[model samples]
Target: MARVSQEHLDARRRQILNGAALCFARNGFHATSMQDVLKEVDLSAGAVYRYFSGKEELIGAIVAEVLETVRDVQECAARESPPPLPDVLIPRVLAQLREVKPGTLGNGEWVFPRLMIQVWTETLRNDELSALMTAGYVKVRAAWANLVESYKVAGLMPEDVDADAMARTMIALAQGFAAQVAVFGAASPEVLRDGLRALMSMGEPRVRP
Candidate 1:
């Protein structure tokens, strides 16, 4: 047999996960099974099992991917030299998610966001998934809180504002937008940007120069 490159291994893994996502999106996470994934990927049960032991494992992997996406955005904030403006960071990250997760609503909708929402909905029953998602959301909220604190220090935010509460509001808005897209269809990037602008403007009153 020809040597399988690391690239090939990674591709195969994604291929299986993509198939699993389709099944979960169509049937919901609790209803989807390893057999469904195998059929979707058109791969042998043996081949698929090598990557995931069962449906739970597959869903876990997908959940991890979603968490990583949020973490990646946080990393951008922590690493950037000047860091992005609050308005820019919120809309930009939400827009990126909207762009990347195309056809998740199925009919010409994105996939990633839909998959995320499926897992999120199922989290109501799955304690394991619930804990994982909750932890990820907490980390993301903390990162946003820190970002808000930075803006406050730079005199861009109001002194009396609560960084933690404001950050939660911002993140909650973004999360709501993501859920809307996953359930309906993709929204215009301007919608999120405009919303963020309005939210952030509360802190920066317009000055008549």
Candidate 2:
């Protein structure tokens, strides 16, 4: 018997992951079963099980993949001369998401963004998933905070601005945008950028005399 090449093994794993992503995106994590993934990938039960033990493991793998992609985007942005502000950075991250995954349902809905929302919900009940998500968020938030420091160094933002708070705000903004896109299926990245810019442009609040 010939041994399988590493490339062949990697490709098989990717195939299983892609199929699982589609199934979860269409029917959600809870509703999607291992059998659904097997049918989607046109692989035998043994073949799929070889890569993933079950649906939970598959969901964890997919979530980990998405989180890794997000971290890569943040790290790339952080390496820039003066990292982009939330307006530019958030949309850039979203664009990269479109580029990397590029998987859409028949109705033209993006796959990963919708899947992310589902994963967020799943994390609440699953401690392992919740821990994974929390760790991912912490790293992403640290990257954003570093970007905020870059803005301060570049004189784009005030020196006194709290980096951690600003990071949380940016994360919230991005997550809210993803939620909008997932639920309404019509959120505009341009509008998100414009809104962030407008918020940034606001003058200090004043009390009426």
Candidate 3:
């Protein structure tokens, strides 16, 4: 018998996570049974059990992956070559919306809507989950804050501009827009993108030398 390497194990874990996301997206957190997840993954019940002992554990992993993905994408955007604050910020924020799982519009309707609703409810009832979500958002906010501060340094922002507050507001707006898109189902991705662009295009009387 051949022994499985750590790389193989890690690949299988990623596959499982992808499958679980699909399953949870379809059936929702409360309605999605372990059996539903089993159908989604190629692994046997015992194999999945080896990683996540229960449904909550599996969901926790999914949530963590989502947060990590957001952090990673934003970090990459922040490192991009020098650009004005609005220019740099727009791409990162829009890229994030473009990548949101279940998606920001269209086909994401059935999957992401239910999933986010479940996560929101879970956050309300589960203190640990709430802490995790808060911490994750804080990390995301910090990345945005750093980029905003960069803009301030470039004189794009007024000296009175609050980078931290603006960053928090940006994140809050994104979250709100996502939830609205999920609920309204009327706004297209193009519309959402334009709205974001408009927000970034806001200007003050100050000019950089």
Candidate 4:
């Protein structure tokens, strides 16, 4: 019997992952069963199981894939000669959040924002997923902190600016934007960009007292 090529194996793996993503995105992690995924992909249970032992593994893979995309965006920003400011970087990140991957529903809707919200909730009950999310958060925040450091070095931000604090703020902003998008379906990257610009243009805040 001829052995399957590595490319063939990888494609099959991706096919399963994509099918699982669709199922999870539509019905959610808890509602999506391995059998549902097997049906979605039109593959035998054994074929799907060969790639993932269970739903949790599939969810982990899908979450990791999304985080990996975010990491790639952050890494690209870090490579810039002068890293982008919050207004620029945040919008870029938001735009990425709106991206529709292959496994996502193709109804011109943003599936990732909703899927991610579900994943965040899952982390509360799943220790392994919580750990995975924490690790991914740390890495992404570290990348943002590095960008903050670069801004300080470039004299764009004040010397006393706290990189970690700024990084946390940026992450919060991005997550909040995603939440809004997930709930309202009205938030746009351009709106976020304009809001950030307006806030930055206000200069430092002062107490009215």
Which candidate comes out best when scored by TM-score? 2
State which candidate, 1 or 4, has the greater TM-score.
4
Q: Using lDDT as the measure, name the better of candidate 1 and candidate 4.
A: 4
Candidate 3 TM-score, C-alpha based: 0.79
* lDDT by residue for model 3 (1-209), tens: 99999999897787777677777766567787888888878779999888889788887887887778767766765676553344334445545534544332236454454566678877888887888898998898888787776666666667778878987776666566557755676455466567767766776968769
User: What 10-residue stretch in candidate 3 is worst by lDDT?
Assistant: 97-106
Give residue 47's lDDT in candidate 2 (0 to 100).
92
Off by over 4 Å in 3: 83-110, 186-188, 201-209
Q: Candidate 2 or 3, higher TM-score?
A: 2
lDDT of 1: 0.76
Tens digits of per-residue lDDT, candidate 1, 97-148, equal: 5443333434666676577688777899999988888888888788888777
Model 2: residues with Cα > 4 Å off, grouped in runs: 1-3, 204-209
Ranking by lDDT: 2, 4, 1, 3
Clashing pairs in 3: none
lDDT at 135 for candidate 3? 93
lDDT of 4 by residue, 1-209 (tens): 99999999999998898788778878889898888998999999889888899998988888887777777788888778788878898888767755525434666556777787899899999999999999988888888888888888888889899989988998888888878877777466878889989888996779798
Model 2 lDDT on a 0 to 1 scale: 0.85
Model 4 segments beyond 4 Å from truth? 1-3, 97-107, 204-209
